[model samples]
Target: MKITLITTGSTADKGPRKVAEYLQKYNHKLEVIFYNENELRQTLSKCKNTDLIVVSANVATHKRASLLIQHLKKLKRPTAYAGIYAALHPEECIKETDLVITAKPAETILELANRLENFQRIADIENLRLKFNKKEIIKNA
Candidate 1:
């Protein structure tokens, strides 16, 4: 799966980086973009082939996360993944996000990895369906 990580503030980068490393171990493609909220807006168009979008809250607050959620919702991406550190629950960050994984560093990494794997499986199935449909169309033609 091609994962795009949009991280705001300094602390938020750690979790996404760790998750990216873990996913890379499984031969998955991961791109970690560390930027403030303003920077994120400027580069939002660069997130291509992004099967999943993971946002970190340690760098900011629910307010910033909310802004991200709104922007992502407009993009209408298939998979919206949100995570928060400290005492914040996933619900506080973004309601439209597909899966919310909340925990401390150690537990968060484990849970995030599991969620990514599950998302990847779903994406794989979708890809197969598209391929089969295209083959059928070609055959009919």
Candidate 2:
């Protein structure tokens, strides 16, 4: 499976970067791209081969996160949000993302990726919030 990690902000945060680094051990293809709004469209256009997208941002990059999620939604791709902003605002993040990843995301994201690839159950992933069904949103506590 191919995964894209789009980190958006004026300054980079450590958490998402660490998670990105950790994910490489799983041997799945991964691309970590630092995105500024100016070049976002161009960057995202190159993501045609991505199986999943993980948008990483913080409070300072709220606008970036929102913008990226909007475009990702338009593309109808499976998308998730990582880092502090998503953790702090799972409700808001879930509105835009297919998955809202809270807390440390590497292991959870790996599990999600593996499940997504193999068609295993996804709702059981730790710290991940998403819809249980179209009628209801599942927010993990």
Spell out the clash pairs found in candidate 2: none
The global C-alpha lDDT for each of the candidates, from Candidate 1 onward, is 0.51, 0.80
Residue 73, candidate 1: Cα error in Å is: 1.4
TM-score of 1: 0.62
Q: Which of the numbered candidates is closest to the native, going by highest lDDT?
A: 2
- For 1-141, candidate 2 gives per-residue lDDT tens digits of 888888886444666567767887888788878888788678778677798889988888877888878887777677888878888888888777668888768887898899999998888788888875554777664
Candidate 1: misplaced stretches above 4 Å? 79-81, 85-87, 94-96, 104-141
On a 0 to 100 scale, what is the lDDT of residue 15 in model 1?
66
User: Which candidate number would show the highest TM-score if scored against the true structure?
Assistant: 2
Which digits, one per residue and each the tens of the lDDT, describe model 1 over residues 59-129? 34556765666677666554333455323553333244554444443344344445556763422221011
